[model samples]
Target: MQKAPERLIDENGFRLDGRRPEEFRPIKLQVGILDNPDGSAFIEQGKNKIIVGVYGPREIHPKHMVLPDRAVIRCRYRMAPFSTEERKNPAPSRREIEISKVIREALEPAVMPEYYPRTVIDIFVEALQCDGGTRCAGIVAASLALADAGISMRELVSACSVGKVEGQIVADLFDLEDKYGEADMPVAIMPNLNKVTLIQMDGKLSRDEFERAFEMALDGCRKIRNLQAEALKRRCEVLTGTEMPEKGSLEAH
Candidate 1:
């Protein structure tokens, strides 16, 4: 088990990386990053680096699992063997299995699977590096990939994690904070729908604390949602040769 931070927060109210309590680590998103996948994206948030690809709306194998009225959503969340301080086993761990199911469920609400009945949409997310919050980061990238792949959807799903560390509620818990924090909660929301798809907690917290952390997580997700939109916009521009607006303007005048 990982041990707690000797000091989760300094008297100056900064985390070990000199971040403020409510601050999220920097995030970088790029869409259509892979050529083979129908849609793909890459993200680097804080110390976590992840890549996600969306494939299909293709036929489902083992045909019996196919839904007559909607498409099947399959998600695989994996961590590279060298992603952590210690080499993770190449085989999936129990936590990874649970997280895979969590991610699939979290993204289901945003997809209009009914349009692609008898098909399947497969999402693959792999972590190249991690410090914490990899799951939420994966959600952001996966949503972008889905859009890049042209999957019909109601809205993108965004996610973030918040927790109480050192008796202070902080947004975007990292490795040390999570290992020692009193509470670590990860929340995913459909950005435009304003509905939560997933909210899981690993530690105890008072109702008041939970409410505050929940709001913080939502706020973080909103910020991430904007970034995701921008990524998709940029990807579109690149594909349509609209990067130089003077000749091929996407903006209406």
Candidate 2:
């Protein structure tokens, strides 16, 4: 581990970047940005940039791998060579493989796999930049891409990471904080259904601290969910001349 900076948080409780414990980095979302993919979306959160493309509900290739009762969901997560200060190898790393699988399973609960039996839904997530929380950001963009593709889903999934930094539970951890933090916990949920699709932790937290962090993460996801709705609404406006829903306006805007 890299040596911790003298302080990750100042006396005023502001983070190194000047954000409060509950604040997230600025986030931007764009949906249906690609012409060829069945569905696509992009997300920029803090310095993490990711694009997701979805294809399918089409026939599954190599028939034997197909499930008779549901669609097969596959996800590929890759960080571009230029994504970070150090050039990443083009070949998928074990971390990429693991993150891809985590993202796939996280999204599966929201998708109605039974609606497209024997078909496949492939999600491609490309990380153009990295700071932290790339996996959660990928999950956010992938859910939007799947929706843009017209896939049947119970609800859109949203995700965020919270951690104990400098003895404080903080929301939306950035790269440096996660590096030196005591604990990092990521959570994903189908907000509308109040269902948790994924939860993973690195390091450890006390029971009370973990509960607080989990709730903080959920609040962040709900905020992101509102942003997702706004993106879809904008896409609808452009494509079909639909008006934005007043009730769906983002809380943090």
Candidate 3:
């Protein structure tokens, strides 16, 4: 059996990235970042960088996959040729297909498919850089891209990963930590209803450890939900040329 490397430590309780157990890595998001797509967004979380593009509620091609009662959500997830330390071949691997399916399933519940029967909503996410948790990051980016395209959704989706390291539960595991940590659990959440749309786990954990990790993931999701809301509000402000009113201004009116 391979032994794990020496655990990361900080005398003040910070992790390798100098973040507290529950704090997330820095995240940057931009909508409409691609020129040719109906909707697109870029998201960077720590060292992970992903771009998501959304096209349609357009007519379904091939004519046979369209359903009578609902629109289909299609997703393709890919890793760029230079996306990792070791170059990945320029082909979609089985892991990418699996992740794409998971992302599509995660977003399907948020969309109202009945509104666009016989059509298709397609999303493509490209991982330009990876350091862990690309699937969760891609899902979040896809949700934002879909919303930016003005598609209706029951709620916005937010995702993050949590893990245990050195007996501490940490949020947003980075590459090294994820590779060496005791466990990793990624979750996709619908914040309005406090429901989970996707959950995946790897590594070993006891029952209590699983519960603790889950709680941490939930908390991370809520924090990310707030950030997502703020990003959308900022985007709307930019598009409409209207500033967000002061907190008490509406009450004053």
Task: Quote the positional error of residue 16 for candidate 1 in Å.
Answer: 0.4
Put down candidate 3 lDDT per residue, 80-181, tens digits, no spaces: 989887888988799898999989988999988898889999999999999989999898889999998878899988999998887788888987788888
Between candidates 2 and 3, the one scoring higher on lDDT is 2
Residue 95 CA error for candidate 3 (Å)?
Answer: 1.3
Score residue 30 of candidate 2 by CA lDDT.
89
Model 2 worst lDDT window (10 residues): 244-253
Give me candidate 1's TM-score against the actual structure: 0.94
lDDT of 1 at 178: 83
Whichever of 1 and 2 has more lDDT, that candidate is 2
Enumerate clash totals for all models, in the order shown: 0, 0, 0
Model 3 clashing residue pairs (backbone): none
222 Cα displacement, candidate 3 (Å)? 0.9
Give Cα distance to truth, residue 194, candidate 2, Å.
Answer: 0.9
The total number of steric clashes, by the backbone 3 Å criterion, in model 3 comes to 0
Whole-model lDDT, candidate 2? 0.91
